[model samples]
Target: MQKNYEYDAVVVGSGPNGLACAIQLQRSGLSVLLIEGSEQIGGGMRSKEFFPGYLSDVCSAIHPMAAGSPFFSQLPLTDYGLEYINPPVLAAHPFDNGTSASLKSSLYETANGLGIDKGDYLDLMQPIVENWPKLAEDILGPFKIPKELIASLQFGLSAMKSAKWLSNRFKTEEAKALFAGMAAHSFLPLDQLSTAAVGLVLMANGHLKGWPLPKGGSQAIANALLSYFESLGGKVQMGWMVRSYGEIPPAKAVIFDTGPKQLIEIAGDHLPSIYKKKASEVSLRPRRI
Candidate 1:
């Protein structure tokens, strides 16, 4: 007997990734059902007045990555009422000496602000900024040998070294502290590997595209994405929690925008032991890394 199905696909979360996934599926001429655990549409993209008359971003505030994202750059989010406010400076790092270093979209401007480390900053960051267009595809997607190899050595070097090791290249406190602050966003100690890549990529994005803020709140981003998806005939359900595989409406495919725990909890024994074993070792955090 043919099973009664709900949609072509069911997206398990309403976060940025989930919304993007649904939108992509819908764009491909598939009927999609977007389910959100919370009553709110956006997940971490949510913003509220935590304090009276004052609104602050709980997770993502600065968005160099989103502004420069190849995927998002293709979307007509502005038509959905999403607006970005670009600040004059991408980021500013202040020191105890009553001085600060500013990062701007222009390579010369940012490098020039580093004072004694001016040359060093340019030397270290120039390769990254120059090679970004070639590396963006591999860096942002699955790991693979870069399609452009000759210019990727600098990128590989940063990926393998620790931010602390890279900091040794700079003599000035401003340069060291600035890189370290950006590296700290990785939620890893600066002495570890992979952290330098985070800082390097972030710095490169700042030079390529200034980190901009959403006009109203981060929620505007989610709203815009969702609105676009809805226009494509996608269906959404808020405050819906699927406790088990049976709870999920029949769909040809299911895309989980949730954590491993949520996957394990909802799918239960349906998943292979190996997958469950690997997923059990992972951890969950509120924001994307």
Candidate 2:
């Protein structure tokens, strides 16, 4: 809105979140610039070709969360070459004995394979899976009073427990392993409070939209978003690793898709002391992949 500013908005990072934010802003008629540190963007969605002819995902492999996303689902990403390949078996957990438990898009089908825990798994997931569309908005967003009150309350009560506590409901190791595998995606200890929420949300996503892989690898998702953003007149720069606020171009608004450490490092002086103290207190550990 300000002519003196270099751009209406500047987004730091070219990850999915950054791309989505830039795309939305550009769609709303804002002049936006997206910057990425790496030569290639994508962040978690980025892929590497370790072998001569094959590609491997750097961080994330499967994508139930993105595929099932209400916002992403509504986007014209598919039209922009963002094809998702949903394998029949969404996710699986193998045992030492060579037996494995797997999940599918069908709730009843996946539950039936859990042996004795079938009944319990069905009972736990039935309501959540049934109300996924209604719950997606509130569950994936900031805390608020949900329009679907009773359903949200039901999901909240169960989702608030630790993964270990929730796992206790299952008798079979297959069921436990499957659920634990999903919960571990949260990157938190299973005994920690609210860890079950991550597992539940992931599982619900699997049921709603099976864990999918982008047709051309994870990069396709980022490329699709970027292409769509560019279609709306957005601009992007790669390998511009910003070290401080001074390195950034002037803009009316700035949005970061980075960690607390990065934020503090780049804009420490501008940040309030109380906010800086809180940000400094955060100790982010590397993912145990």
Candidate 3:
């Protein structure tokens, strides 16, 4: 069969990870084609005006890991007219009793807000904060077992003991409520083991790097990246969907930013049966939902 299109690489979907991959491939002197099924680009990092001129982030309002995020932080977005702003307090959890506990990006300030459990909170977080660089690298990197994150992972295992463990650690209701509110961000049940790890990590980030949002909107970040990709000679095509291998251009590599199921549906015959079985169990990590 004769192929219809040609490129060194074709990246399906224009999400951050896809864009990043396309940008890097183009930078390395490869001809790259970025295809987006949606009419507009910036998949999940998209923004819209909810009220008149007031723009609201459609999804992922606060970017806690952007600065510590190895992939995003390395992109010189600012040079392309993209900027980020950090609110003084990272995030605040308001309790029913009219009291709120906020993350200040400062250990002492956060501990002071915790009052009675101040000392214990500091003791638990200091080591993590001290090793945040290593923590950031290991957690964000494409490493299954990065050496720097071993201690943090072990610490995380112990921290996974829920609000019940926290109640035993602190004698104050205020402290417990504060931690509880933070843990609820996990979407998992509060008592679930996953809640403990998520809440603790988020709180630690608050005391280390305050939650920041890109100024102008999330699209600005995407535009910056898109500009860079174009600068490196990458071509992006909007409103294009790869339905099968026939739809893909002749290329050495084809990467999909779409769902893994879509990948299987599009290329199942080319892939090993066992590979498709395993991929069926594995969710696409790049997707936000």
Q: Taking the tens digit of each residue's C-alpha lDDT, what string does model 3 give over 165-209? A: 654676667667667777777766666554676667667666666
How close to the true structure is residue 96 of candidate 2, measured as C-alpha lDDT?
90
Instruction: Give one digit per residue, the lDDT tens place, for model 1 in 1-289.
Output: 7666769899999988899899989999999999998888888888778998888776787778877887787789999998988888888898788899888889899888888889999988898898897788777887778788866766887766889999999998888989999898888877887789889889998888778899988988889999999999999999988788888888999999998999998996789989998998876543323
- Candidate 2, residues 1-289, lDDT tens digits: the string is 4368878999999988998889889889899999999999888899889898898888877899899888788789988899999988988888899999999999999999999999999999999999989999888888899999999999989899889899999999999999999899878988888889999999988898989999889998888888888888999999999999999998988899998889989988899989988988886774332
lDDT of 2: 0.90
Q: List candidate 3 segments past 4 Å from native.
A: 1-6, 141-143, 159-168, 282-289
C-alpha RMSD values across all candidates? 2.9, 2.6, 4.1
lDDT of model 1 at residue 166? 92
lDDT (CA) for every model shown? 0.86, 0.90, 0.77
Relative to the true structure, candidate 2 has a C-alpha RMSD (angstroms) of 2.6
Q: State the displacement of the C-alpha of residue 273, model 1, in Å, after optimal TM-score superposition.
A: 1.8
Per-model clash counts, in order, read 0, 0, 0
Report the CA-based lDDT of candidate 1 relative to the real structure.
0.86
Model with the higher lDDT, candidate 1 or 3:
1
